[model samples]
Target: MSTVLPDQLGHFGRFGGRFMPEALIAPLDELTRAWQEAMADPEFTGEFDRMLREYAGVPSLLYDATRLSEAAGARILLKREDLNHTGAHKVRNALGQALLTKRMGKTRVIAETGAGQHGVATATACAYLDLECVVYMGEVDTERQALNVARMKLLGAEVISVKTGSRTLKDAINDALRDWVASVDKTHYILGTAAGAHPFPAMVRDFVRGIGDEARAQSLELLGRLPDAAVASVGGGSNAIGLFAAFIPDAEVKLYGIEPGGDGFETGRHAATISAGQVGVLHGARSFLLQDEDGQTIESHSISAGLDYPGVGPEHAWLADTGRASYRPITDAEAMEAFRLLSRTEGIIPAIESAHAVAGALDIAKELGPEATILVNLSGRGDKDMDTASKWFGLIDAPEAGRE
Candidate 1:
């Protein structure tokens, strides 16, 4: 919980630091200074707070999911971030960075996204702030998350499909960073998650830490104490880190980060970086990454586009190393099953990314027994994932002509 992490150089115990091209140093420095100044300024902070409450719909509900608890064999409370303006926790970081962009006198914002929630959030922020926006998304993700892509377009943001590399989150980041290197003068690259270099890991966490902040107070009010565990799905780890931040000081509150186990560990197609990856540098940070023997980044697979990244935020890497938090993988099948279960039981269709955490929490609930309470960050809704969910669940099958 100390501010010491990310040191003066942005390294989180040899995990985070600028690994970008030299050309980016000046802009990164500028952004860091701007963020610091904004954080220290009451007007900036006040406006940001106002926007979160009035616009992004912060202080999201912490609902007690009684039905879900019965299914999991443990008390369950869900921090419902899915009800945010852009339908995901990504909106917090997007709005924060967008405000910083304006404060820095930048007129344009460029971002990269997977599953398209971040892109949609960025586009929404840009529209609200009257700034130009551009989003880079993987070709595969654009197809799977078409609804979000359409939302971004309707918000007046330009969406570019990056077809390079694995055509996923990592590759989209590659193209976004490339764009930033050339447009740093008039543009700000709103890195979607907490991964990237230096300030991003720290700054994005600060922006989204509201999740944990609210959840902590709500838990005390509702449950009369902290939950036994804080749970969330981790890809670039923004939501997980946000939810874990406020609980870090509570030694009794365990943290669980669920990574995507796409097809299972033996298949080598999962994105369970912290659980199975080797330490390596990727996307400008040293973290646990899925890579080959030759040190090439491996292509990560997941039923959920948002949880399909190959590397995690460096802070998560540090947490895993320090054993302050536990990281595990929930296979795609397990995640999908949870996804279906939540929809049927509670009428809450979670984003497949969040389903990973749901699946993990169920197992943890059983392990900890019925007396324990588990808080899960329901990071986003499944509206944007209808296409993928329909395909996965076979919900689009042809109906009988006279069935009605």
Candidate 2:
């Protein structure tokens, strides 16, 4: 199918643009040109495909969820991104960008991460390519996602804890951007998701489009046709975009992006950008942003560190506005419940971020009923969330008596 989006100037309607410091404009344009040239080169794409197969583990499984399907009253199928090399879909973009960095003759790679999956993936890629790696993470996130931080460090990345702003993902981005500005000549900022400046939203999405490409073919091969719905969790929205890209022209396939509803959007405690946000510029892209009356970005909260963000990808905002796709809020309680349900029913412990999609699929499945088939992107594994999960489910005793 033909695709028509993110027009010549890198806009998904009015949502995406080069809204950044003047200094970043030239670099972004250069990167965009390089990416376009590489995409057109058969040898470049061929090598990328080879790396995906030999290293990053492309073509992840599409598992049929028998018990979960019965519970949801629909045929639930999971696109198992969690089974990838670094236990998440983030590796796809990481390896792709790492190769691009090498092609551009950059020596070091830098990145910012929330739950640390992207940091781990970037670090892993740098290690594989023998490049220097640096990862910036929010101080709060570092504490909660300690395992992933250790994993990044183990992979030889120098992890920096940003103690600014809300001490979360946004702050990490701020610091990473500053680092990139100073070290652009030798460093490549591996923007983790499908957000940020012009090329980033497009570049990262293209790098990871394999998710949708594979799932589309796999669905037809295994189920005789495409799925009725495609559901995935959205923070910066890379995974969701990657899964949505291949089906954009399939009018029969519905797309749903699950945002972190946290306590509730009503309480002003969630990261439900599309559901409760306005068009504003943040982290370069003009998209649905959680902000105040004066347009200052509000701090986003979510039990899942990965979903704690105030802005979404520009393409998602365009998709919502154009009525081509929909976005829904999934609260922490609902996400955790779905997390446990999947573990119990399918013996799969999905990351809390992915649980949002699982919960959303369950909700959608109810309306669609048994005849419809739902495909949910199981974005990552829950191994890194054992501590948080243990606390939430009371699986372990508190450190101090009556701590709560």
Candidate 3:
């Protein structure tokens, strides 16, 4: 790669821009400059690869899911990022960028999180790299994902709760952006999605492409052919893209991006962007967003913290628009059922976000029959969701239970 900066400003084909206050321009310039150099540096390459292999556990296997296939009626496989060190694909991009932050001489990592998986992953990187970590989460998310909150605290991160707006992911991003503008020095915004401003979609995609790269090679080696379809849950859509990108040029593979439908799509309480969305601007990128008729972003509700955001990634928007990929919604109840079934039947407790993908796979499998192969990106594990799961399943007290 040439690693050259584009004079055209921060854009990925009319999707991303640094649309921010004037005072933030200089820091964005500095960030762009440093990232360009870091990409070109041989020292950074060697170190990043070493850390990926030794610490973060790159090259997670693509396994043939015989049981899932048998039950679902299609031959199924999984690119198991859930097996990664921090139990999520988020760590791959987080670690790569945290290393770059060190190279830029920045000592703090800041990010906005919804479900808190990204926050925990970033905090883990800061712990290893000895950098300060700050995460902004919506107050509602902080309450829903308390286990992840404790995980970040255990990893030495400071979490701030934003009570503004609707107390969800969109508000969290706004709050994080505010913090970024204020503390431009010693702080790199460790964005969780492959969206946001320029350099982010492409940059994060490049870093996390390891998942797809590995899956492609591993699938062929194990199955002796390309899978019929690849599926991943899309919140901000990094995992889906990371896995889908490597298979796009294959031509034989069908790609599906599963978004969270908190309820039914017609019910208005969902995050099914491509399925129930419109073109809108959010978090510095133009993507399919859950917005109202007046263009205000609507609050998306999903049982999965990782998939409760209002926007799909910019690249995903392009893919859906261009007809290169398919996007669909899997409802919250369906996802929870899939999560529990996968655990009980196969001992795999997938992250709720990942469970959405599994739920999609089951539906696809029924249509494809037993001969077709489907590869799902198991984006993360579900251990961080024990509390929420217990409550949701009625095994424990609800937040408002016994409130007579």
Q: Write the per-residue lDDT of candidate 1 for residues 1-404, one digit (tens) a residue.
A: 56458897788887988899999999999999999899999999999999999999998999999999998999999999999988999999999999999999999999999999999999999999999999999998898788888999999999999999989999999999999999999999999899988899999999999999999999999978899999999999999999999998898999999999999999998999999999999988899999999999999988889999999999999999988999999998999899998998899989999999999999999889999999999999998877777767667775522211
Model 1 misplaced regions, further than 4 Å: 1-3, 398-404
Clashes of each: 0, 0, 0
Report every candidate's CA lDDT: 0.93, 0.93, 0.85
All candidates: CA RMSD (Å) = 2.6, 1.3, 2.8
Q: Which candidate do you rate higher for TM-score, 2 or 3? A: 2
Show pairs that collide, candidate 2: none
Q: What is the TM-score of each candidate against the true structure?
A: 0.97, 0.98, 0.94
What lDDT does candidate 1 reach at residue 135?
98
Tens digit per residue, CA lDDT, model 2, 1-404: 33667887779988998788888888888888888999899988999999999887788999999999999999999999999999999999999999999988999999999999999999999999999999999999999999999999999999999999999999999999999988998989999999998889989999999999999999999999999999999988999999999999999999999999999878889999999999999999899999999999999989999999999999999999998899999999999999999999999999999999999999999988889999999999999987888888878776732211
TM-score of 1: 0.97
Tell me model 2's lDDT, rounded to 2 decimals: 0.93
Query: Model 3 — which ten-residue stretch has the worst lDDT?
Result: 1-10
